[model samples]
Target: MLDELLARIEGRDFTIGIIGMGYVGLPLALTAVDRGFRVLGFDVDPDRVAQLNAGVSAIKHIPSASIAAAVSAGSFSATCDMNRLGEPDAILIAVPTPLDRHQDPDLSYVVKSTEAIARRLRAGQLVVLESTTWPGTTTEVMKPILEAGGLRAGKDFFLAFSPEREDPGNPKYSNAIIPKVVGADDPASRALACRLYDNLVAGTVPVSSSATAEAVKLTENIFRSVNIALVNELKLIYDAMGINVWEVIDAAKSKPFGYMAFYPGPGLGGHCIPIDPFYLSWKAREFEVPTRFIELAGLINNAMPQHVVHRLAEAIDKQSGRGLNGARVLIIGMAYKKNVDDMRESPSLRLTELIEARGAHTDYHDPHIPVIPRTREHAALAGRQSVALTPEVLASYDAVLIATDHDDVDWGHVVAHARLVVDTRNACAGIDTDKVVRA
Candidate 1:
């Protein structure tokens, strides 16, 4: 059965159905279509479906021309309907796996999407999960769900886990160029999934099992979280000794071996780095094991936002001759990282709340994000608009905090006009300024 599916995929006779047309799914769908597969994008969000159907790319990294050309060529289309699943030869799940308020792995999206796919499961159809999740999520949670349609995996159907490695705002590495990691419950299923990805991506790396594939994805993010925490902890220590961590990192990066530099910041942000490690830490608890490094990294990274607030207070008091209470504080960027609109789990929200809690008037400016959403701790400060980062506007605030270092922002203007600046992202590295404080 897997051989037959592979033959059909090789002939470009497969209809690829990509579920959840967000950052990961949209790019994958486009790449599949580019590789000559007839692709159907399914999403529960009506707005996203509408945008894709209209040939408008909502994701910043994806080119509108690429989507428009794909749609116009009749190889790609999007719908909110689940019935479209039956038309595809293979299905890919790219839904979000976020954490809940208790910091537990929220698998609601994964579970719901799995059930929807299972309802339309057909014989000889391959299923691949592209969401970043825990080790047992694919074989344990999703396998049984797919088997509910009376189709056995690796026999009547195929299932695999191929986590999406999407780096938003990166023009160098794309969906097609990044190496894909593929693993399945059985060898047949693995080969089928591997062939499918190899045709679309630059290369396909096969893993031992679905659990190993899932754990591989988690390990990558956990490595980043731990290293980032190490640097953040060192930032605090080096600050007390009047040492610049950025300069130290610059000098240390000169060594070729055994040192990959990870910078300290206000806090961790984005969907994967800040939250995905905790998913592994949560799953490790089941086997009477503890992920001490992940937990410690999360603790240190989570606390950095509040630490930035405290640093801002000191900077404002020393430079502006005022307390945090009632002082005007401006956040330069709200997006999680530089030059991207994605703000999921961005620490800037927490930084904003910490400032507001201290009775400071906080505002933000992001070309990508026009308005800030109302988070649990920042409901009262909702509906804030992005102020223009001009010289005049920069001078109006008591202090400006560089939360995100977007490319469009005028760092020179900010360095020249602002009375005091708390540089969390090292965005003001080249600019000469006396009132700059690195957080």
Candidate 2:
């Protein structure tokens, strides 16, 4: 079965089925089609599937022309139906593994996708999970569910875990340029996964087991979370001492050997850094261990949103001779990062609420995101449209908070017209105006 699958892949005769056609899956599907393999995209959202099938992109960074090219080639297709799940020679699950309300790992998406695959399990099919999850998820959580279909993972079919390293708006690294890590306990499964990825990515790294692959993903994100937390903590301390944290980072980065700079922000955002570290912390309890650094990082990073609001309040009081109540404030960016329209775990939502809770009328503008979509939390800020940033509009606000540093905004106009400007990202650097305050 394994040999036949490999032959199909090598001959470009096999079909690739990707579940959860979101950020990770869509790019992979396009890459696979470019590599001369048939690709089937699966999504539970009928609207998203329809958009994809019609050569339209739901993500801002991924252009519709790319989707149109893939659809025009006739090797790529998307559907909401699961019965076609049996037609693919290889399956990759890239669904989300978000945290639950209590900050625990929520494996509901992984479990459901696994269950769906188990029902249609067959010999000669290779299954690889590309979702970021806890170390034991692929083995302990998914293996049992898969075996319940009366097919052994290694013998009858192949199973492996390959962590997805998709950076949404990163121009330097795409799905094909980034190195892929494939791991499995079974030799055949690992070889098949590595071979498949070798064709799609620039390089392939083989690891010992699925657990290690899972740990690699967590370790990468935890490193980011901890370093960011350190910078954020230092920013608060340095602010009290009247030191510029951005200047400190510029000087410290001169060493070039011992330090890699991670800037302080309103808070941690995006799907990975904010949530992936908690997976390891939650898993550490089973071994009677303490992840002190992870816990501390979580505490410091989580506090940054409120701290930003407090800083904004202070700026407004000092610059304008009035309190936060009845003040009109405008937020510059709503997305978590620049050059993309993704808002999962965005700190801007919290900042908006904190500003509004203090009796300020808050409005936001993101060129990428025209309208704020409904989130599980922060429903009060949903359906809000982006406000145009004219010179007249900028001057009317009691304070302007730069939550995200998008490159498209006219910084000169903002620095010139705003009554009081609180810059979190050092975006107003080099302006050297009395009206601008770095938070």
Candidate 3:
């Protein structure tokens, strides 16, 4: 079984099945198809599957032309059927591993995906989990489920873990070019996973155990979360001193090797930084280890939305002599970061909720997101459409809050027309006016 699977992988004559066709799985499927392998994408969302099958792209960064090309080449297709799980020579799980309401590591999605694959377990197939999860999940959680069907891992089938490194809208990187870290308990599973990704990506970094690979991904995100928290703390400190944190960072980053600039924003966002740190913290409690630094960083990052909202209220009161109550505020950007429509763990949603909680009315303007869709936490913000950034629209607002630093917006137009602008991302850096204030 191993030799046959290896030969098929070498010859590119095998099918690759990917589960959870979102930001990670779809790109992986497209990359595999580009590498001369047939690919199948599985998703629970019927609408998403139908849209992908009809050659429409669900993600904004990924073009429809690419999906259309993959479908036209007969190498890629999306489906909601889990019964076809055993048909592919290799199955990759790229599902979400979000934290629960209590901020505990939620592996429900991962567990469900594994259960579906276990029902159709077959020999000569490799199963690799690409989800960012707790360190021992591949072996501790998934192994038992996959072995429940009377097949052994690394013998009847192979198992590995390789976390996905996907940066949406980052032109410099893609799933196919990023170096993958592949690890497994057995050498055969590790080699097979490495060989597969080496053919798909730029290179592979092999590790001794799946736990190490899992820890590597968590550490990466934790590093980002900590640095962002540091800068966020610095932003507050410098604000008290009446010093511009953005200018300080711009100059401090000029030192080539010593400083890597991480800007302070409204708060953390995206799939990894906001949520992946808690996965490790939750797992750390199993061994009675206290992750104080991680928990502190999480606290600091979580407090940013409230700080921005407070600043908005203060600015509104100072300028208009009125509180957030009965104020009509316009948020400049709706999506988490810049030039992307992904709002997975965005702080903007919390800002909207907080602003409304204080009796202020909130509207948003985003180039990418036309109408706000329902989110897991911010479902009440559903169906709210993006308003235009016209002169009349800008003038009508009590305060224009710049939450995201998307390059598509006109800062000049906003400052020229709005009564007051509260800049959270330092989006309007050089605009010197009493109407514009950095939050």
Candidate 4:
């Protein structure tokens, strides 16, 4: 069985099914198709399925031409059906692993995906979980579910964990180029998973166990969260001392060795950095061990959005000669990153909510995201259109806060027109503006 599977993978004849066809899954599916594999993208969202089937790319980085090419070639298709799972030689779960209200790991989506796959489990099929979650999720939580199908993991079906390392809006790396880490419940499963990924990606690094692979993904995010928090803390300190943190980062980045530059921002955003670290921290509590650094970093990163609100309030008070009450503040961007439309765990939403709660009228402008869905906190502000980025409109706000520094936004116009500016992303750099304040 293993030898036949390896042959199929090497020959690129393997049919790859990617569950949860969102940002991560769509790119992976398209990359597999580009690498000469038949790909099936599965998503519960009917709208997403419709969009993909129509050759329309929902993700910002994925080109519509790629989707059109794949669909026209009959190498890729999107569906909401679970019964089609039986056709794939390998299944990859890219479902979301979000946190609940109390910051606990929410495994409902994972469990649902696992159940969908288990119902169609057959011999000689490999299942890999690519969702970021706590360590042992593959070996402990998903293993039993797959085994309940009257088949064992290593003997009947192969299982592994390879966390998704997707950086949206980063042009340097794509799904086919990123180094993937693969680990399994046993050596045979590990080898099979590695071979499958090796056929598509640039490189595949195999680890000892699925737990270690899971931990590797979590650790990477935790490192980012910590470093970003460190820079954010430094930003506050430097601001108090009247030193520009961006200049300090630029100077320090000149070092050739032992230095990695992480810029300060409104806060840590995106699905991975802000949320993935807590999965490990939550799991650690079961062993009576507290992840102090992870907790501290999260605390500082989460608090930054509120701190931005405070700073914006101060700037508004100073410039407008009034309190936050009835003040019109414009947020420059709404996406988590500069150029992507993804808003999962975005700090901009939190900052906007904070501003609105403080009695300030808040509006945002993003070329990428014109309308934001109502989240838990921003439910009242749903269906709001993005404000125009013209100089005259920008001048109408009492203060403008640059939340996400999108490349398409006219920063010079914003600097030239806004009455007062609070830039959390240092978007106002190189612009001659006395009204600018950097967080």
Query: What TM-score goes with each of the models?
Result: 0.97, 0.99, 0.99, 0.98
Q: Residue 26 in model 1: shift from native, Å?
A: 0.7
lDDT of 3 by residue, 325-424 (tens): 9999999788888999988888888999999999999999999889889988989999999999999999999999999989889898899999999999
Residue pairs in candidate 3 whose N, alpha carbon or C atoms collide under 3 angstroms: none
CA shift at 164, candidate 1, in angstroms?
Answer: 0.7
Evaluate all candidate structures by whole-model CA lDDT and list the values in order. 0.89, 0.92, 0.93, 0.89
lDDT per residue as tens, model 2, 262-290 = 99999988989999999999999999999
Looking at candidate 1, the ten consecutive residues that score lowest on lDDT are: 373-382
TM-score of 1: 0.97
RMSD from true fold, candidate 4: 1.1
| Candidate 2 ranges with C-alpha deviation above 4 Å | none
Off by over 4 Å in 4: none
Cα error, residue 422 of model 2, in Å, equals 0.4
Q: 1 or 4, which is superior by TM-score?
A: 4
Candidate 2: residue 263 lDDT (0-100): 98
